[model samples]
Target chain A: MNEAEIIQKLQQGNEQAFRHLVENYQKRVVNTCYGLVQNTEDAEDIAQDVFVEVFRSIGSFRADAKLSTWLYRIAVNRSLNHIRDNKKRKWFQSFEDAVKEKKAGLLHYATENPGTELENLQRANILHEAISSLPENQRTAFTLNKYEELSYKEIAEIMDVSVASVESLIHRAKT
Target chain B: MNCNTLHTKMIFFLEGELPEREMEEIKIHLESCTDCAAFAEEMKKTLAVLETDKTPQLNPFFYTRVKARLEKQAEEKVVTQRIPVFARILQPAIFSVLLLAGIYTGIKIGQPAKINSDQSVYTENEMIPYLNEMEAEAIENFLME
Candidate 1:
């Protein structure tokens, strides 16, 4: 079905249309969340929330805005919220809890790739920590640009910022 | 270019965003300066993490899980909707019952006072006349004395 028709069907609460929407956008949504959260499981979980939100609130969606942009916005917001909520847990777990968690996480990664996964996982962890240290907007812009490979203009549209702001954020993030 | 200038432009150069001339200049500087070269190498490795940590694919069961969640949500919604409807109906009914009870209680409390006032009306009138007679008698005795 066409975009308008699909939206109409979704607004009408058609499960088929919902399934179609999920099929079309699921990977991108997960990838967007993954870019920010840097965890495959959390990314998928947040992506599910994103879809559920879209399904629940599809009636309020303005037709003028692209669905993909809305999806990305939700994914980004959800991932950031997840991070914020995790911050408390992280603070409390800064002791031996962190080490145990890291060990558990490393084991999880090791199962996927027996040999090189640990090194790559460690690199990814360091990179994620660095990205997490950045200001929220800079981190967001950089993540979208680097991980999702989105253009500055696209990031601007999703973030509702000027392209110049996105460029400046990314430059700051890189530096 | 000096190290400071090259350092500022290193990110843009690494991203291939700088102009060709500036890119060439930075490249020449990095070729000679070990410090700048090492920094550039580190930056490259950091940026490469994005490539190495490949974007994860959505699981095939993603839609199924979403569908299950949606269904569960819908079910909870039905239960939730039932409650508000009950509350919507119950709230005003309870308020109205309490209001009627209040009015009834008020009327009941007020009735005794009305009854008491009615019963005391004759006594008050009789007491006044008797008091006047006593005063009159006392005045007459005092006048005679």
Candidate 2:
């Protein structure tokens, strides 16, 4: 069925529609969440939360925006929340322990970002750390632009900001 | 064009959004400007690294896991939606009972304590402090008189 048909069935509380929704969106949602959280397990958890939230609130969706954009908003929000929650947990670590932890994580780089070259994975990690330190809006804009390959216009729509603002955000992020 | 103009358009050039003339101009500019060339190269490297930085694919049973969670959640929603009569009524019942207890206590405390304040009972935590203050006030007034 088309998206409209699927949405109608979903609104009607059809289990099949729900299953179809999950099947259709599970990967993209997980990937988007993973892009923000940088942890596979946490991304999966957030993906689950996003789908559940979409399912519960599908009735309220006004169709004013594309479904995927709405889903992106949810995925990004959940991933950011997970990062913020874990922030405090990692706040008390000693510098040596943190370095050791970084080395340990680097040891598992292949699993951390699958499909990355072994040599380039360290560079990727550094870039990810830089991106992580960006303010939330910049990070979101950059991730959506680079990872999802979204246009600045689409990202502006997702973020409820102007296109010029998205351009500025991405420019600042890149700099 | 100047370096700032070239830098501003670098992202668009890389994205292939710039027109042929502008792209050619930037390419010609990049050839002569070592700084812009290095910046472009760095941007390309960053893009390459980020290109491979995709989220790792989950195991094949990902759909199964999601479906299971949905089913479990659906079951939970149903269970919670049912809202047993006792459970539904019990919350407000408990709240009202506590509220009534508070009001009763307040009234009892504020009442003219016949066994205590006799008539000028003030609403204080304990009767002793109010009685002491009232007695002191009376003594002061008498001394003033």
DockQ, in order, for the candidates? Answer: 0.36, 0.26
> How high is the lDDT of residue B86 in model 1?
78
Q: Could you list the CA RMSD of all candidates, in the order they appear?
A: 10.2, 11.6
Per-residue accuracy of model 1 over A63-120 as CA lDDT, tens digit each: 8778888899999999999999988889877678888876776666556445755556
lDDT of 2 at B145: 89
Which is the leading candidate under TM-score?
Answer: 1
Instruction: Pull out the clashing pairs in model 1.
Output: none
Clashing pairs in 2: none
For model 2, state the Cα shift of residue B42 in Å: 4.6
lDDT of 2 by residue, A17-51 (tens): 88888888787888788778766667788898888
TM-scores for every candidate against the unseen true structure: 0.75, 0.68
Off by over 4 Å in 1: A110-118, B2-8, B83-145
lDDT of 2: 0.81
